[model samples]
Target: MPRFAANLSMLYNEHGFLDRFAAAARDGFKAVEFLFPYAFAPAELAARLQDNGLRQVLFNAPPGDWDGGERGIACIPGREAEFRDGFLRALEYAQALDCPRIHVMAGLAPVGRRREELKATYMENLGWAARQAAKAGRSVLLEPINTRDMPGFFLNFQEEAHRIVEDIGAKNLLVQMDLYHCQIMEGDLAARIRKYLPTGRVGHFQIAGVPGRFEPDVGEVNYAYLFGVIDEAAAQCGWDGWIGCEYKPRRGAVPYGTGEGLGWLRSPVLPGV
Candidate 1:
């Protein structure tokens, strides 16, 4: 069976951010991931993780002016200094939190900007970030988000992300494959998983229902079959990574709706249930 991590940003919304840790732990998740941790002190977040016995599997680096709609600055020319500073700050948080991976969002491609220019900047920044992360015994992740949900996201395909990782030749730089986005942009989920898992380029995964972005079970994608594929591929590739439950609760934030919607986790399709 695959280990699961609750995305506190989307799940457990019934409670405050801090309180969501305990709620996730109470519902049987041993690991967790969130969008960002800059809002709270590192020490405070660390205490929450320790108290709940949950591992911090992942979190994203600072995307420039999040409230003002900048998805990231890594690919935006002239923001190199800002991107480096933000990444270093994220690294400090990752080290303090004992988190192994930090996702570096490829900024939205600027309108009218040359693709080659943006690509050059993105690869350069990723290479630098990967080198920095290597020194700390940590890995940097790049996720290909669907343009539908995040219009203008710079990275939008698995092959494109893998190509960046390959071109950079940084072992510490890897891809974060979100199945939800994969289904949106491409349909061969199983084939893609089998193809990438053993290549050792994929470092993490996120899942949600199609159309609604709800719990995995509610989606048109057959998570049960996909989970089985993951188990087989993992056995062959020796990949033991966490699958982040990054989805909204269909039942809404009605106290235990998130927990209640976790029937898929308890199904016989997954082992150790």
Candidate 2:
């Protein structure tokens, strides 16, 4: 069976971190992924995972000024020190939580900056972060967000992300192809997955509806077909990874509707698995 991980941030917004972990476990999720867990100590988070029999699939490095519209700054010039500090802190948490992957937020490029200079800065900082993560036996991930939601954001398309990973030349650096953003930015989802699977650079996956970023069934993307494509690719390449459900609930989480919401995703990814 294709393993599914619940994105705690999107689900159970009513609960705190620990409560969300418990809720996910109750809902039959064997693994979980959080967007950012910097607010709590890693040791404490690890204990919660152990008690609940959950595995940490992925989490992101802290995006400085997340509330102030500074989503990330790793690729911006003159902010190298801040980026390094942010990554180091995330690495510490990853080690404690035994997380295998950490997503690196490229943030937005500075205004009036040439694309060449911005790309160079991004490569340099990623090299540094990749080395740091390697020492801990973990990989660094680069995610491509949609330009519609995040204007001026660097690394908004799959082709550009692939080129950046190739140029970095670090074994530990990989691409996180978020299907929702990819569908919004680039419509050919399965083709892009097949194109990047050969490189083994695609480290993680996330999904939601395109128009609303809500449950997969309500959107234009056919997840059943998408999962079939992914399963075929994984079999061809002998790859096993978690596919995360990172969608927002259509309504508040209630006992009556929660089952229907989750049941929509309960369909088997691979038949007879």
Candidate 3:
């Protein structure tokens, strides 16, 4: 079975941060990922993970103005110094949490900016970030968020993410293929996985039902079949990684809830497995 990671950031908004971590542990998840850990001291977060026996599978480099719609800045020109400082801050947190991977969010390029210039800046920052991560024995990932969900984002498609990875040519840099974005940008999910798996660019994955961006069964993505495809690809590529549950709960967390929706977690390994 593919290892599973809980994205605590999405799991329990009603609960306090530490309480959310406790819930994830209680649910039997051994690994977890978060969007940003800058809110708390790195040592405090690390202590919580250690107490709960959870491995920090993934977390993102700090994105400036996280609440003001500044998704990230690695690709923004003239902000290279700010981007580097944010990345280093994340590296320190990663070390404290013993995280093996840190994702570098590719923020939206400025309006009226030339694509060539944005692409060049993206590569330059990624190369520098990758080197820093490598020094810490960690891998840096570049994620492609869908423009439909996040308009004006610099990198929105797998093809562009692939090209960027190729251009950087850093062994430590890779792409994070979020299934939610993939379903919106590209329909042939399995084929895309196969094409990118060989390049070793798929460093992480996030799953959600398309259309609704809710739990797997709430939309038309057919995750049962999708998981099967992922399993096959992992077997073929020898990928031993965690699949993050990064989606919103249908009716919020109901400790006493009952339905097929919640039961999907127990759904057998996708058909072909």
Candidate 4:
């Protein structure tokens, strides 16, 4: 079994964001990850993790204007400065929380732009972020979001993402493989996991149901089997990082609370380590 992390941004929605830290720890989660930490003070989030005894595994670098439909700013060509500034801000938070990874969203590529230029800008931004993270003793992750979810999402295919990771050529920069999006954009989950295992390039991992983005147990992806695959991948890669439970809880008559849908993840990663 893999070590699991509660994605406070997704799981534990029954409580406020700050309170989710405690809720996760109460439910036997040893670690936590989230989408953004910009809304609260880094010191406050750090305090919550300390109080709850949870490790901050991962979070995304700032995406530009999330409310205005911009998924990220890194690949947006002219937003290089903004992207760097956002990365620095996120790094500050990561440092405070003792987080090890930051997901850099590639942003939605506008239809009329030059694809080459877009890729260049994204690579430049990620290279810079990777260098900074390396200096901070952290890693940078780039996730390939499915086009179905965001329409114009810049990074969509596994091959493309792999190519970008190689092209960037930074040891601290790797793929944040989200099983839900990978199943949507590409279907060879096991093969891909094994292929990347040799390089140990997968920096972080997330899971959700394929068609509905809900609990993994309810998905087209056989999470039970896939969980085994994940373990193999991690073993081969020598990875002991968090497997983030990034999904919606299966709704019941009452709202989903902490641990309501965790029967699928019964295996303990260790005997309390």
Task: Give candidate 3's total backbone clashes.
Answer: 0
Per-model CA lDDT versus the true structure: 0.93, 0.85, 0.83, 0.86
Model 4: residues with Cα > 4 Å off, grouped in runs: 252-255, 267-273
Model 3 Cα lDDT, one tens digit per residue, 19-114: 777778777778899899988999899888989999999999988787899888988899999999999998999899999999998897789889
In model 2, the clashing pairs are none
Strongest candidate by lDDT: 1
lDDT of 2 at 213: 88
By descending lDDT, how would the candidates be arranged?
A: 1, 4, 2, 3
Q: Candidates 1 and 4: which is better by lDDT?
A: 1
- Encode model 1's per-residue lDDT on 46-129: one tens digit a residue: 999999999999999999999999898899999999999999999999998999999999989999999999999999999999
lDDT of 2 at 187: 89
For model 1, give the 10-residue run with minimal summed lDDT: 264-273
Q: Write the residue-wise lDDT of candidate 4 on 1-273 in tens digits.
A: 888899988987777788888888887899999999999999999999999999999999999999999999889888989999999999899899999999999999988999999999999999999999999999999999988988989899877888889988999988888889999999888888778756778887789988998888876888777767778767766887778999988762245564777877764232211
Q: Which candidate leads in TM-score?
A: 1
User: lDDT per residue, candidate 2, 2-80, as tens digits?
Assistant: 5789899888776766788888888899999988998887888999899999999999898889988897888898889
Clashes of 2: 0
